[model samples]
Target chain A: MYERFWRLRGDKTTIIIPGWQSMSYLSDTSNICWFLEAEFAKEVVRLHKVVGNAVTEGRHIVVGTGSSQLILAALYALSSPDAHEPISVVSAAPYYSSYPSMADYQKSGLYKWAGDAESFDKEGPYIELVTSPNNPDGFRRRSMVNRSQGLLIHDLAYYWPQYTPISSPSDHDLTLFTVSKSTGHAGMRIGWALVKDKEVAKKMTKFIELNTIGVSKDSQLRAAKVLKAVSDSCEQENSKNEESFFKYSYKLMAQRWKQLREVVEAGELFTLPQFSPAFCTFFGQEMDPQPAFMWLKCEGDIEDCESFLRGHKVLTRSGKHFGASPKYVRISMLDTDETFIQLIDRLLAIQERE
Target chain B: MYERFWRLRGDKTTIIIPGWQSMSYLSDTSNICWFLEAEFAKEVVRLHKVVGNAVTEGRHIVVGTGSSQLILAALYALSSPDAHEPISVVSAAPYYSSYPSMADYQKSGLYKWAGDAESFDKEGPYIELVTSPNNPDGFRRRSMVNRSQGLLIHDLAYYWPQYTPISSPSDHDLTLFTVSKSTGHAGMRIGWALVKDKEVAKKMTKFIELNTIGVSKDSQLRAAKVLKAVSDSCEQENSKNEESFFKYSYKLMAQRWKQLREVVEAGELFTLPQFSPAFCTFFGQEMDPQPAFMWLKCEGDIEDCESFLRGHKVLTRSGKHFGASPKYVRISMLDTDETFIQLIDRLLAIQERE
Candidate 1:
């Protein structure tokens, strides 16, 4: 949430972003000056092109903000005046917490949180954000009311083919992606918005410019370099496409999902929602988290959730963050094979003891 | 900027953003990612902590977007808002264009292009921004409005001793620095902010949340590594203090400035007024650019100053951008030593011919 990691002493959490230089959005000329390998340098350029275009279409992506959330706030700002014509932000129940945060951003109390747009009011500047393979619950997506009808900013952060296989290709009016989920490089604050409609994109870009002078050039170039490197890495890994990135991402999540399922089946109490057939859903909380993070909740007590796990060196998000009351916790199926296995083993040991 | 660089066949300007994997926010663990050798990463962090009170004073630094323009925007968002009375943004004219851009983000326009407190209505909730060795004029900062007096964000983007050495230390609430001028990695969007106020820091962090999630994990780590690499490179080259970055930066600017100065020194051919020691200003009637961009006024046979520059194989920003009439023109000081010098050489040659 805060730049907490900067202050904390060394922890086991793996920071996988540094190793991805040549694979991202760096320019070709970048190779000459950077320490990354030539191959990685080329990759940076390749990914950069793909990511940048997603936001800036013709001329410059006019609307600008540090992240997609600012525009979300602006959208709230633009629509808040019409209270009766209520603008609702509808997303899947187990959605990115930030969806509601946007509502808070505008201080628009009018826009109450209604889980996905399917259930919410269908009219107005309703923001329908679908994080492909939703966070906390890794569901690629679900059927939704048409996005063309209103304000739908698809947070495709985890939707990249790297993590989930896209089923029913969604050509929404707007789609958002950030480097954090795709590359495990959450520190770099760069996100791009892809939109078919020019006005929407223009508004978003303009918002950003007004809010935060056009995005940081250094970050943008770095993002561009990383994107190029990743794409190139995926391409070079296999001839046809980004087979490796897709394969690696899918395999990692799939394997972890299996492990989490096994834990749940083993008398471990946790509400596992129906995830999109394409991806995995980790948790279903009974309540909202004020400041607490979500983790897999069980009916019985697992002696210690935080401290004991810390002893095992296994960390999971505390569920208090998602909602008011808390019953279920959340876990991301985003670890390596050994790490996943280790997490499962730790969970099992605790479960048996409980 | 568009993320994709490869897909576009014609002009290769767009680049995609790589995920956090390409950033370097940490210094201890994995380091050394980019092709560019940078010592600025170390200095940036060191100065940020000393100035910001965010970290234990360390010798190393980190990098992000250059100029801290976006960083400033993010900080404004994160810092406390003057909800009672709209926040005020004050900066000297011909200051960094981002001041106004950032000020205009949301709520009330924060960064107004004003000269002093006098320009602003005498009121509260004002953020006085003072750019040291300011952007276009290269003047050392002289304002000392206390932080407790109100909100003050300083743009020490180029306050280093090399370019605009200070005789007496200047004071402010927050200071910003970037690697672009310090290192040659303008492409890497890395900048750091130093603030003494903790509460203000918290608010700035909040604002950052709305923007991009966080700084790039990859870029952060890479910056950590680059800090080491840069220190090594500069040490090898015997680079001294912050001046190492400045020597190169100043050398580049001085050379180009000399060439352009020589031309201006010679003629009734080109007229530049907006440019003090900071930026070079000119006038060519046939140019149109947005307000805040370099302005130009053309008195000679030039109708389209923009076209004339294009014809001369040098790109000059048309004056219309700053919302000024199209009769003016401006040339920024943002180019490599070779490129900028070449541009001046070309212009000087034209003057000689005339």
Candidate 2:
């Protein structure tokens, strides 16, 4: 998908990690190397400013193998060692599916996975995962349980300018971001957390140390390169008409969303979520829907929308996987142009048959 | 130091990882990729055969970020979910210092770190960690506790040809190896486990997946290249005169051990452990002492050998840190040539003054 875009940029986005580089177990300054730490912090701050999604000031940045690892690390850091019982971990319904498995796989006595936040009534310390511009559904959300005793981990994975409007800079105690969704470099597996509390950061660092020693210096170096390229393109003057990464991503996603919605609307047998125009600070104008995923609800006796889509050879994640109704399904809008075209064609053919 | 040797080899040891080489979250295969996994397995088996140290036949190869992560993964896999209580984890005295901390850090309900294996009596089900060519003492060790309920995880980080003689092919159910000690690429942080049981391997795989998704593909690729280079060097008929990694490492370690022994013997204030010359299958001769660390015991009024060494501006890990007596200290024989020379000079000076 983005490979074409990256190819167009050629060596501008290229990174080369040399052998014998970072062979020492210890990083230069801190547990995380000074070069990597500095680059990550600077790029993250710059990206946030350019996108207007998250506030990065006064936050201790801890890097991980990916946001997936950091998610577990954050949970480990938040859970108290002295607690008599295991801390409960919860997220809202229709959440990212991997949350449950990752939290409980270790079967660590420190924390246990309790279901959705709405149903969790346990009287103890808990960590609520808040994924804004949620995975299954493309709606912005907030913590439903407003308790001082609970800690919130804001997983802002899909809150970049390409997926959603930059309504405001999210100010949270602990927030996670990854290069996967932001730059479509998921293979690199570089993710970071912005932690306000030093103690929490320290604990998270320990978790990372125990988990994989630390993130790969090579990956970190590459991530730093990719991030700098993105920031440079955005900051460069007269580059709006140029092939900027975000612009390319936003335009492609918006076009896909529009085409899919048009076909579904014509079908009249299914409906898509309605997202009105929203102000985007980065683009300096109102933007249409450009979600990472398209949430589709089956109408007129289509109980299993995922199965129905599969019948058309268009595979989608069943809504039941997200703790939602079977009538709904989540289709990724971020596939390659060819795949998206095939999806649109299949969807339109279904409408014609109906 | 090995840097001098590496400089001599020049770009032959160089590895360049491209920017977009491995960007997918998943590998080409399962926990590790097909190419890397096959290369690692083949190289590991070949190396073991060359060194005649560990049995690789009928073993399942599991790669990790490092042997450190695999240490915890092994413990997690060995501990049963239905166990009446947390499984006890024990290692012999002068064990790897990080074992206790790594085992109990998560405060996992699955396992608890018990003290040295010699005093472990209350254990119903236990996992005994056996680090052959042990960390501080550098002695080949076996599990003292011969109980049916006790499982063993052999940390073979020091089992390479440079550190110890190839006595026999160790046929342990669970054995851990790392690239750090083997190739002096400690920065790469690649490790592997040779497991005899499929169930245990599956559990370990699950643990890694839940931990960091998996080890870095970039690191894995680099490791494969390094391992292949090592194997190629060792297998070549006339390569003994060439820059073979093991040959170079052995020569450096053997020389360092001899020099350090001479100085300590002249000092008379400290006594080093006496290791008898053993026949090495790899070298096909009775090799001189080449332990990774010099276990120095204070002979006179020096109750704290580590402090005495520190007073002379030589930094060495304290014996107490490895669950040994303060009278003993462990000096690394793997330091840079300059550092080692300075250490020898300091020791000779102290002896001359005394």
* Winning candidate number (DockQ): 2
State residue A125's C-alpha deviation in candidate 2, in Å.
3.1
Report how closely model 2 matches the true complex, as a DockQ value: 0.50
Pairs that collide in candidate 2 are: A23-B187, A187-B23, A187-B24
Candidate chain B TM-scores, in order:
0.63, 0.94
Error of 2 at A13 (Å): 3.5
Q: Write the per-residue lDDT of candidate 1 for residues A205-292, one digit (tens) a residue.
A: 4554344334443444454455554555554664654334434544545556666667767865443554334321211112111111
Count of clashing pairs, candidate 2: 3
Show how many residue pairs clash in every candidate, following the order shown: 168, 3
Task: Give the candidate number with the greatest lDDT.
Answer: 2
Q: Candidate 2: what lDDT? A: 0.81
Worst 10 residues of 1 chain A by lDDT: A283-292
TM-score of each: 0.65, 0.91
**Candidate 2 per-residue C-alpha lDDT over A57-161 given as tens digits, one digit per residue, 9 for 90 to 100:** 888888887798899889989998888888989999888878888877667888888979988887867999999889878888899777878999999999888
Q: After superposition, how far is residue A50 of candidate 1 from its true place, in Å?
A: 14
